[model samples]
Target chain A: MALPSVSRRLRHPFPFAILAIALSLSTGVASAKLRVVASTPDVADMARQIGGDRVSVVTIANPRQDPHKVPVRPSFATRLHRADALVVQGLGLEHAFIPALIEGARNGNILPGAPGYIDASLYVKPLQVPSSQNRSQGELHPLGNPHFNLDPVQGKRMARAIAEGLERVDPSGADDYREGLERFTTLLDEKIEEWARLAEPLRGVKVVSYHNDLIYLANRYGLLQVGTIEIKPGIQPTPGHLENLLRLMKRENVKIIIREISYDPGVARSLAERTGARVVPLAVMAGGLGPEGYVDSIQANLEALVGAVAESGSP
Target chain B: MSFRFHVGRESRRGGAALALILAAGSPLPVGAADSDATTLHEQLEATQREAERTRDEVAELKRHVADLEAAARSADATPTTTARIAPVNADNPAVSFVVDTALDVSTQSSWQSIGYPDGWNFTLKNGELFISAPIDPFLRGYASINGTSDEGFDVEEAAIITTSLPWGLTLKGGRFFADVGRLPHWHDEALPFVDRPPSIDRMIGGESGSEGLEASWLMPIDLFIEVTGGLYDAVGSENLETLNDNGFFGRRSFQELNFLGRIHGYVDLSDTFNAELGGSWTGIPRDEERSLWALDVTLRHQPGTQSSYQGLDLGAEWMWNSQRFTERDDGGAIMSRIRRRRQGGYAYVEAFFARRFSVGARFDYSESPEGAADRARTASAFVTWKPSEFQRVRFQFDNSWGDQQTNQRFTIQWTAFIGSHSHGFAQR
Candidate 1:
C-alpha cells in the first residue's frame, strides 16, 4: 500500500509473538484470570476445579490450619490486587480479619455490593446460626455455622454457585466453567454417599471433638457430637474448664473424644486417661490429611471414621 | 453450642452439670487397657461434681453479661421502644427493628460580633435515620450541616459503608471524612487519658471532607507486623477553589496526592511491658504554600500481671512544619517555599492505670519561630468508660492557660456499630 505503512508493518513483525505471550499469560497470571482467594484448602481445591486452568486460586489457610484462628498475611493485599473475585465461607466461621481484609483491598468486583463477590454459605443450607454470641455463654455463629464445606452435597452446590458467578463476570469461557463444575459435583455426590455408608458403623456413636466445627459431618453419620475439648474457640481449657469437662464425661460415661491433628493432643489425651474415653480426632474440611480432590477427600474421611470407630468400640 | 439435660438429672443435681466429665469423655470403646479404669473414673467423677456446681454459676454469670450487652446495643438505637422477647415457640421466625438518631447542637460566639452577637450556633450535628436488622446487610445515609461561628453552611461528613467486596474488603464512598489522623477525626471520639496530644492534633494541621475516592489497603504482612493504608483525598471542602466557585467550571481544588500513610509496628519487649511504636503522616499543601510533615511516636509499658498495679501506656510525638504562603481558606496553602520554616513540634506523655480507671495528661507548646504570630500552652484531664466493645462514654476538660486564654469543655459521646443490614422488605 503506502510506503510508510509497508515499512511500519515490516518493522513490527511480532504480532504472532504477542498473541502467544498473551495466551501464555492467560494461564500463568493467577491474579488476572478468574482470581479466586479461598479461605481453606478444600475451597481452594473446589475453586481450582470449577475454574480449571483459567483461574488463579490462592487459599488463605492451610488444610489442617484451624479455620477459626487463621491469621492474615501482608501479601494478601497484593493477592487482592490480582484477584478478580473472592469466594469465601461467610457463615461467621472464619477468623476476625476476614471482614477487615475484604474491606482493605484493590479488587473492586469483590466488594460486598459487587457481582463478582460470592459467599459460598449463601448457596448452602447453613446450620447452627445462634441467637447471639454474648460472651456470657459459649461462642456462637450468628449467621449459621460457617463450616458448611464439610458437607459434600453442600460443597458441590457451593461449587456450582461459585462457577455461575465466575461465568457471569466472564462469559467468554462459560461452557468450560459449567463443564468443570459438573464434573466436580458429579464426583462429589457419588463419594459423599459412599462415605456415609462407610461411616455407618460409627453412626450414633457418642463423640467428643477438639472444636464444634464438625457438627455437619457428625449429623450426616449420626455421630453424636457430645462436647468439645475446648471451652472456647481459641482458648485452651483452664483448670476449671478441664475439671468440669471431666465430671461431665464421667457422669455420662462417654468413651470417645474426637481430636483434630491441628490442636494440642496433650489435654485431650490426659482427659481421655482420666475418664477412660477413647479419643477420636476428626477432620473438619476436605484435604485435611486426606485426598486431594472432592471425592478423594470424602473417601479419606470415611476410612478415617471407620478406623476411629473400630479403634474405639462404642459403649 | 450443644447442651442437653435428662429430665431426671436436672432435678437431682443443683444444675445440669453433674455429668461434666462424663459428658466430654463419653468415649467409644476404641482401646483395651482402659476398660477396668474405674478408680480414675470415680475420682474424676467426684471432683467434677464440685466443679459442676461452680460451672453453673459461671455459665449464668456469662449469660447474664451477654444478655445485658445485647440489650444495651438494642437500646442505643431503639431508645424508647421496649425490647420484644423472642416468640414462645421456635416455629415462628423472629423479627425486631430499631432506629437510631443523633442530635448535636453547637454554639460559637465569634469575636467579630458584627451586627448582632455575630456567632453561629444551631443544629449542625449529624442526624441519621438508622434502620437495623440482626439478619441482614444495610444502607445508611446521613445529613450533616456544620455552621462554624465563621464558616456558615459547612458540610462536615456523611456516607454509608457497605459489606460487599470482591476480595473480602468493605467498600465506602460518598462525601465521607478523609482518613487524616487525630486532627480531622471525631473530636469527642479521642481517648481522654490526656488532652488531645498536640503532635497528633495542633502539629498536624488538617481539614474535613473527601471528594474523589478512597480504597483502604490491608497489606498482607506476616503474623507479627500488621500493615494497612488508604488511598484517599488530600484536600477538604468540595470547593476546589472558592475565588471561582462555579459548581460546574470551578477551578479544580488542589489535586489530592495519595492520602497520608499509617504504619504501626508493635513488639513485645518483655514480661512486664509491651512496647508499640506507631508513625503517621499525610501529604497536604500548607498555609505557607509548602507540603508539611507530621510524625508521632508512642512508647507504653505495663508491669506484669502479678504486680499490684495493673499496667500503663505512655507515649509522645514531634510534628514541625514551616513554609511560604498562597491562599486557601480550606487550609491548603502549599509549602512550596519550605525556606520560611513555619514549623512546630509537641512532646506528650499519657499513661493509663488498670485499663479500666486511670489518668492521662499532656502539655503542648507551639509558635511560628520568628514571632510573626503567637505561641500557646494547654493542660487537660479526662475520664473514660468502655462499658462494652461497641459502647463508650467520655468526659473531658481542657485549660488553655496561654495566648488562647483559659477555656474548658465538657463532652459526652456514644457509638453503635450495626455492621451489615439486609433490606429484603424494601426491595420486595
Candidate 2:
C-alpha cells in the first residue's frame, strides 16, 4: 500500500503548483500593458489617447459601417477575450452587439458594473433623454442620445474616464495614464477654441440633417436643426413626410444640410436641390474619411461646416 | 432620577413654608397659633398632592421612554424586511420571434417523393421564439422553441452557458445542436439558403441536435483555435430509430452514449479576407456502431473600409459516415454482419454585389445510404433581397439527379424577425 501510494503521488506530483507558477509568469508579462476593447472607432481613439504606449486597443465597429448595424463577429469575441478593460458609449448605443460579445468573451473583468468597465456617457451629460419609453417615439435611446463623442469637450471627459479605467486595472502605470490624459485635454481644449472661432459664421445657421446623429456636432457649433430627411429614426421617408419637411425647410430658410457618409446621399441631394441649401457630407467617426485620428477628424468636420456655411451665404 | 426627586422635595418644602407665613399674616385669624397649625396642615396635604403628581409625571416619562425604545426596535426590523426584498432588473432579457415560411412548387407530385408527408407543398417552414438572459454574474441562459407545420412544436435549444469561466473555457449544458458540421450547427432561419444542401440532408440528416453537455476552450494564442468536446444521450431524432429499436440494442449503458469532438481554427489573412476551418467527429454505439467525420472550410472577404453588406462568402463541407450492423435473420439464424460507408458533401459560393442583394450557387454530391440506390447530385442557385437587418426574402431553384429519378423545385422564402435580438437570422 505504501509503494502504490508513493507511485500515485509521484504520478501527479506538483501539477497544480506547476500550473500556478506558469499562470503567474504569464500574468506578470500581460500586466505590464493594458489591453482595451472599445465598442466604436471613436472610443478606440480616445482610449489610445489616454493609454498611450502602455496600452493596446481594438475596436469592434468600423468607421465606415453604421454603428447601429455592426455585425456580431467571432473575431470581436476573440478581441474582447484578451481585453483587460472595456470602454463603451453606453446609453444603449451598442445594445445590439456588445452584450453578446461580452457574454461570448466570458471576461469577468470587463463585465458591466466591474471596475475595469467604463461607460463614457457617465462623464458627459446626455441630450434627448426621452420622457416616455414608448415605441412610437421611433427608435429612441431610453437613457439619452449617445453621440456626445462628436463634441470635443465631451470627448475630453470620455478620455479622462478611460484613463481612470486603465489606471484601475494597471495601477503601476497610473502616473503615466494621468500624464497622457492631461496632455490630451490641453491639446483638445486649444483645438476646441480654434474650431469654435472657425465655426463663428455657422452660429444661428439653420440646418437639416439626414439623421439625428449630428445633434451633438450641431449643438457644439450653435446650429439650429430644422428637420430630418427620414420620417423616423430608421424609417424611410414617405412622400407626405418629405412634403412636410420641404415646407418646414422653406419656412425656416435652412441654410445647409448635413448628411453622414454612411447614409445614401440621394435623398440629401434632392432635398438640397429643392431648397437651394448646400449639402455637406460629414464623417461621423474617426477613420471614416481617411486614416485620421480623433482630433484631426473633428477638425475636418468643422472645416466642412465652415465651408458649407460660406457657400450658403450669410445666415 | 435622584436629582429630579431632590428638586421636587425642595419645591414642596418651600411651598409649605410660604403658605404657613401667608396664614400667619392673615387678619381674620382668631388664634395665631391655631391658624398657623391649620395652614401648616393644608400645606402638608398640598405638598403630598404635589409629590403624587410629580411621581405620576415620572411614571409617564418612563412609559414614553419605553415606547420610544420599542419604536426604535421596530424601525430596526423594518429595514431587514425591505433589504431582503430587491428590485427586479429593469433591463429584461431580449425576446425575439422569427417566422420563416415558404411557397414550394416542385415537379414531384406527391409528398412521399420528397421523403416527408408534408413536404412538396406550401407550408410554414419554421416559427421560432427565442429568449435569452444572463442568469447571474457567472452564467447566461438561452432557450428557443420551434414550431413547424408538419411537426407541431419542439424545444429546439435550451442551454445554460458559463460566462465567466477562466482561461477562455465555456461550459454548456442542456439540449443543443451537435457541433458536428457547419450547416448542422446553424438554425434553419440562420441558413444562407432556403433549404439544406441535398448531401447533408440525405446523409447525416438536416439540423440534427441532441441533449448534451459540451466544453469548449479557446486557446491562448494569436490565432483563433477552439477545441470542443461533448457527450449526448443521442445524436438526434433522425438517428434515434436506426440506433435504438427498443430492444437489447437500445441505449442501456454509458457505452451507448454519443461522443463528439471538434477542432476549429480561424485566421485573418488581410483586412478584407479571413478563413475558418473546422474538423468534427462523432461516434454512437448500438446494434449498429455509427461514426461520422466532417471537415469544413469557409473563406470570407469584406473590406473594412466598405459597407458590411458588400462581401463574399465561400464555404465547403465534406462528411463521411460508417456503420456496422449485427442482426439475426427472419429464419432465426444469425445473418452476415453488414458494414456500410457513405460519403457526402457540398460546396457553395456567394457574393454580395450590392448592399441589399446577394446571389449564391451550391453543388451537392452524396453516396446513397441504401445499397441498391445510385449516387445523388444536385445543383442549386439562390438570390436574396434584404431590405433591412430584420427582414429577408429569397428565391431559390434546385435541380437534382439520382438513379431513375430527376427532380426540379422552386422555392420562395420570406423570413422576418421582430422585437429585440442580438443574433439576426442571416448572421452566419
Give the winner by lDDT.
2
Candidate lDDT values, in order = 0.53, 0.77
Please give, for residues B1-428, the per-residue lDDT of candidate 2 as tens digits.
78487657858686767767676766755686686778677877777776777778778888999999999999887775535645486657778989899997878543232352224677789989999888998888888888989878978889888878999998989877777778877888888899877677666666656777999887665455667889887665556434545665445566567777777767678766888788787776554566787889999887633355578999999988887766788986868789888888999999986656899999988876663255777789999987555678999988777663677778999998776544421134
What shift in Å separates residue B390 of candidate 1 from its native position after superposition? 7.5
Q: lDDT score of model 1?
A: 0.53
**Model 2 deviation from the true structure expressed as Cα RMSD, one decimal place:** 15.8
Q: DockQ, in order, for the candidates?
A: 0.03, 0.11
Pairs clashing in candidate 2?
none
TM-score attained by chain A of model 1: 0.84
Compose the digit string of candidate 1's lDDT tens values, residues B240-283.
22322666533334432334444443344653444434444444
Clashes of 1: 86
Error of 1 at B51 (Å): 62
Q: Which 10-residue window in model 2 chain B sums to the lowest lDDT?
A: B110-119
